[model samples]
Target: MPFILTRITRDGLSRLMAKYVVGQIVCHERGWMDTHMKQIKKDCIGWHTFHSFRSLDQLTVGVMGLGKIGLTTAKVLKGFGCRVHGLVRTPRSHSSVEPFVDQLWHGREGLADFLKDCDYLVNLMPSTPLTHGLLGDEVLTGASRRPVIVNVGRGDIITEADLLKALEQGWIFAAVLDCYEKEPIPEDSFLWTHPRVVMTPHNSYNNNEDYKRHHIQTEFIVNFENFLAGQPLTGEVDWQTGY
Candidate 1:
């Protein structure tokens, strides 16, 4: 059988994930959900108790792995008047993300500096040798801002034990996790009950099955045409880089 390499177009998915990140930042970092829940339960209606909440415009956000999803997230945050920062494996000239990012960091050498002052750190990196367990004690400890962790990336990017320690030790504020080191997260996991955690079962990319199938078929048709025309195919994987 002949194989035709293809992938679901990320434009729509990237936009959706970007919006999800913003929603997570607003609800988790600013304590909106907690406040709302309290009001619904008739626990408290006073505004003073929630005065600590900050506006999105006042935040400084850092995005790791400035790929399609990361770039989209940064752009959406910038639209809310945030000072956006981005981390990439290497530098690029005239990149699409340049306009949105106030500051950019290149490679692991600059990771510490990139994370230091961020009010929110969004992770969108893939699972790779360079990224596995990249956000452990050393990296988390360097964040002076005690940033809220927003991870929609591969879960292994963070060490679960170290993340728990960071929260316990106050190295970070809270977390909005859509992915985890383990699927189904085990019945005995602390993350399920952690006061500062808001988690989802990796549902960020979910959509109607029919809708997804339509897009996948469209992508395949486009790639097939490109192949016949001897044109560069979209979503071509770089085996060496493992993206």
Candidate 2:
């Protein structure tokens, strides 16, 4: 391990912040801002449409990946009075999960059960061969709660075709997507016009304060200092796992 020199950046903080921001947007249904503005402009005071929404306390947020980012997200969501859950491949003891969430579902066999009652879903997994089309028709169909899918993870995890179908049929409530299979989503893509969807240009990890605070370099410096002092460095990469 000493043979390799690596650095820690704002990966964790960025992802953690992204999850919190996305969760707030989804839970508060802020995606309809444009539509609401248009309605307000259409009529000065006559036309009124009210939306029934639930508080975060009344909803369960399911995190698809139990990694650092997902765990941080879940922990933060807990502060907001929301119940958090994680999806795992197997029942394993994780320090991060213990303090954050009590409910966890295992693998494909457990995904359906995990999604059955979740009010919101957050994705933080990377794109991998085993993850391609992971959230397909069957998975989406199994989601009976009509949860909002907030994907800060890879876009390929949920095929656009299947996602569109799910949205059309109302299998899920809505989607808040930050990443896409296609980076610059095509100009003609229907998602751009989808009423129930909120799309960001893979900018979920961006925060203006990050630069002002020098967060990335600060993390690296702290980790480097710890390494020099023979203290355990945070955000150390595991080559075997490529994390």
Candidate RMSDs in Å, in order, are 2.7, 3.7
Off by over 4 Å in 1: 1-5, 39-41, 44-51, 94-96, 224-231
Candidate 2 ranges with C-alpha deviation above 4 Å: 1-23, 26-35, 45-48, 89-91, 94-96, 209-213, 220-242
Per-residue lDDT over 13-92 for candidate 1, one digit per residue giving the tens place of the 0 to 100 score: 88878988998887776677777777877876463474577888999999998888888888899989999988887676
Worst 10 residues of 1 by lDDT: 1-10
Tens digit per residue, CA lDDT, model 2, 85-137: 88964467656477788688777778888888888888877666656788986
TM-score of each: 0.89, 0.80
lDDT of 1: 0.84
* Alpha-carbon shift of residue 73 in model 1 (angstroms): 1.5
Output candidate 1 Cα RMSD: 2.7
Q: What local distance difference test score does each model get?
A: 0.84, 0.75
Best by TM-score: 1
